[model samples]
Target: MENRIDFVNWLDPDMSIQILTCLDDLSDLLRVTCVSRCWRQYVIANGLCRQLCLRMFPQLSKVVHVVEQRYGTKDPAEVGSSNFMEWQNLEREHRAYAFLARGCTTFPIRDLISEPICASSTDNYPEESIDNTLEPRDVVAQRASYWSSKGNSNPAEPEMLLYKLMGDLCVITEVSIQPFEAYFQWGLPIYSAKAVRFRMGHPKSPVDVPLGESYKDYENKFIWTYTSQEFPMAQENRLQTFKLPEPVLCIGGFLLIELLGRVQRQDMDGLFYIWFAPSSLFNCSFLVFMVNCCELFQDQCASTLIEYFVILAIIFSHNVYVTDQL
Candidate 1:
């Protein structure tokens, strides 16, 4: 009589797969791998970790393949059988997917704007400056603050805001914007655009893009990695969120905001204006996870250096004593 229980043997393979697919947490999947040798093999061979990651974030499907970057590793050619090679491939997938899932689920949230680059046009130099948008509050120094575009007789003339992110690489997920309401004006119109679009990219050259200046083909300076769909903006004096279709891997760290159409007209000037506070970029950086590991490596290198120097000192001392005695 069989004393040990094996669920995989008792149930159909499809049933077993269905049961495992229900697991959503990476920790739980990891625990499943630890149950027994057979269990570990089953999980890895089926590529469950990769499947779980793809299920949670379909955006990751863009990753065509996973290539290991491990150094000080020998080529698998000398160590191989067909079965062993297959198992190695499965093992690599298991580790890669697990790390991807962890990063996607656990990155920290923070505002990623380094500085406001420029606005297409400014209505007032000091009072309605683009820099004021960086201040979170609408009021600064006891005065209502906002960045306003130059009024245009053509309502269709779009406006733009450009900003530099905190780092050279970023995974941007969302953006926050607030339309400026001119409380001081009659009817208290909120100067919100009809629609908004976002683009993420890097500069064409290292130092070609000039500050406080722009050219006719200003976009030529950037190589955009991601461009979001145009989302309708509400005409309200409140913070609005525009979440990306997928988390964008922004290589060049520059962000562009396009305000598509003008909604409100200034009664005194009979022209349309786009007014907004400085927007915030929400992102997670891969650099954060690797910092601790880099610190650990640095500490180990320091210890090794100390040990190496002590060994050299002892050898030198022994040689000097022998020479003097002779």
Candidate 2:
């Protein structure tokens, strides 16, 4: 009987890399690393993960340069070591991409908000409390139950929402907002802002300042890290996603959402509404493979579907439980 030769071992290293490059799934790529020492070495040597990350998020190219610059001036002895410099560079890229992937892959929605944060607006009705929009839930009785500011005479004055993330550091890629639609009304008027802006940073002092001092006072003290471009908001009640021009590395945890312009309700008596839900505020991480797949098929299909069912499955299997509170 002839001995069977392992194709992977026989194949040229470059050919193996080319074959592996076709795999877009991060999990699958990670699995390949565990197949054998040869496979692992080949994958690491070529910096497959780093390449995949860069392919997914071109913005990561900037990060790669920053990393290179930080570690460039190594000792001559270290540099002279056989493939040591190459290996080190690849490892650094792998780590950076892994960190970015963690932020984008699985979003802990429940853990997103650090505390019971509220917007700087008066709650008009108890039913339409701001807290209602914090989590995903079915529409309650088809009523416009959402947080609304008191009737503002001048719509130009901006209304703001202040909140903090669960983590001190966050790489923000996208922000989603949903305006409240008064479906119960005749025309189903959607209360939305003409424009929206975001600011992220850390406060100079502890944010536990007295309430009477005002949020504006605390906001003025914050050292902003990034300010997003003013995105035009559509006057639609449904959830709308707005992708930032670039990813923002927010060192500080605080986030401020500014709603601009006055949208009047034709049904309501001259009252301007800035109605929104806490559920509307979504900070989406950019998943490279999913996004690329979507774009690839976008022109062929009427709609693109990029579902993170893994996240949902995990949540259902672990986080959810039957309670006896009833």
Candidate 3:
């Protein structure tokens, strides 16, 4: 019988690349690299992951700025001397895209704050406290109550709620808010806001101040890193998610939700009640697994997860803002 080579070995580099390009799943690509030393080297050396990342998130093209800034002053001869550094850059891009994708898939929800502290408010109903918003949706013991602001019909005047994130940097994709509908009341009308705006930043001063103590003067104490365009909210009682135009990189770990417009009043008390759901931070285990297996290349997967894995959680006080009419 005539001797025949294995299918993968028989294929030329170009043909191999063409076949690998058909794989859309990152997991499949990772597995393919493990098939052989030749395949692993081919995948990394050819920057297939970088190509895949670019295809997935075209915005990553902006990474050119990062590359230029990092290597701008390097000698041309040194830069061209070895492809190792180029491969490393591609690996970083690949890892970042993978992490982002993983985050989008698994929306691990958690309450950033156990109880939010009300900062500045026109009025506070003892029963309708700011802490009411943080209660779990399924809690059967407590009826659905919400954080309400005093009657203010002005669109320019807005109520604000501040939350502090204590975890590592989080790439926020969406924020959700629910309007409280008094079902037991005569008419089950929803108390919705005209619009909502978000701001994220780091506090200029230390945030160690006690919940309701020093936060009364928090407005001027923080520096905003990002401000989102106003998003119109629905007049519905159910949970509504407002997706950001693009994912925001929240570095400073403070989120400010600004409620715009007056509450649609049903009774003499012209107030708006917001049924806030606990904000969820996306956490994915696959990202950690991939980082350990693909990036570290160490058999010590257990240690890798312990060292690099981080879960997102928010820690803050029960502070509400009741703004006066502007």
Candidate 4:
């Protein structure tokens, strides 16, 4: 017996809902909404869908697409450069969304991003200091002054402490009181030296008299600061906090761009690229795919229909709990 069927009527509410849920699980939570009005409403009405959208869709989208663009293998059958460019565009969007989804911290996140390598314990010294014999003779004999042409001929002459090899000039400033570690980077070593001048602290009007020498004898010197190419400290400036007022989307994109620059500079490793690339690519690919698909079927799918589907896709398949899935 042949089965009599009406295609439109066959799509019962329950069946439609089940199909959407399945789409949410399989393809994309956001994509499923594009299927139909009922699917859109069902995903929207469910709180689970919202959470999934937050956790999975935006963030994961950033990861997948970013990586696929720059490092994706070329395929003859694929669109190649065009898709790669498209991926880059989406990568920017994904990054912005991801950054917003997870609040980006400005406190030198890059430092934590890289793996720590063990080196000499320059900060903490052991109670039992190594004998002079353990240290290199050159370092041990180091004096407090820059070497001058006047030379070691006069024992009265002070020797330079930190020498920039290949140059005769040496610096000796009165900044730091005790021996302190200088944060050095890019071949420039920060010296913890005090300035030679002081600021006046006079309560005028002939009220406060002079206390021995005027306050002109000393100035507050800034030292003991580490210099990183990532975060540079301006002279005379102390630590301060700044707020980011950008939308979560814009900030996320900025962070991604920052990450890319660092990666290109070789400051970060391949693992970071691996971690971020996937999510970025995914977002780009999915968004672009949806946009293209909608445009292609515009004759049948109205713009509102496309939007509804996109929103539904975000809802049903969205997985908020899916963290670091890539």
Better of 1 and 2 by TM-score: 1
Q: Per-residue lDDT for 1-326 in model 1, tens only?
A: 86986886688988988899999899999999999999998899899999997786553454555544333345454598988877887887787678656655666557667777777788877677767777767677888878888899998898887888765545677787888889998999999999999887666665445454432347666666577899999999888888887666554568899989999999998999998854433232222111011111223533432211100010121121100110
lDDT by residue (tens digit), candidate 4, 162-200: 101111101111111111112222432222112111111
C-alpha lDDT score of every prediction, in listed order? 0.69, 0.60, 0.55, 0.23
Model 4 bad stretches (over 4 Å): 1-19, 24-27, 54-326
Candidate 2 has a TM-score of 0.52
Model 1: which residue pairs collide?
133-278
> What local lDDT does model 3 show for residue 14?
82
Model 4 lDDT vs. the true structure? Answer: 0.23
Per-candidate clash tally: 1, 1, 14, 46
RMSD of 2: 14.0
Worst 10 residues of 1 by lDDT: 308-317
Cα misplacement distance, residue 50 of candidate 2 (Å): 16
Model 2 scores a C-alpha lDDT of 0.60
RMSD per model, one decimal: 12.3, 14.0, 10.6, 23.4
TM-score of each: 0.65, 0.52, 0.53, 0.19
Give the per-residue lDDT of model 2 (tens digit) for 1-326.
Answer: 99987556788877877889898768888788788887777777788887776675443443314232221234433555667766676665565555455455554343355543555665454555555555465366665446676677687868777767765545667777788776667877777888999887666655574422235556567766578889999887678888888666554467788888867654556767788754776444432211111111232333654331111000121122111110
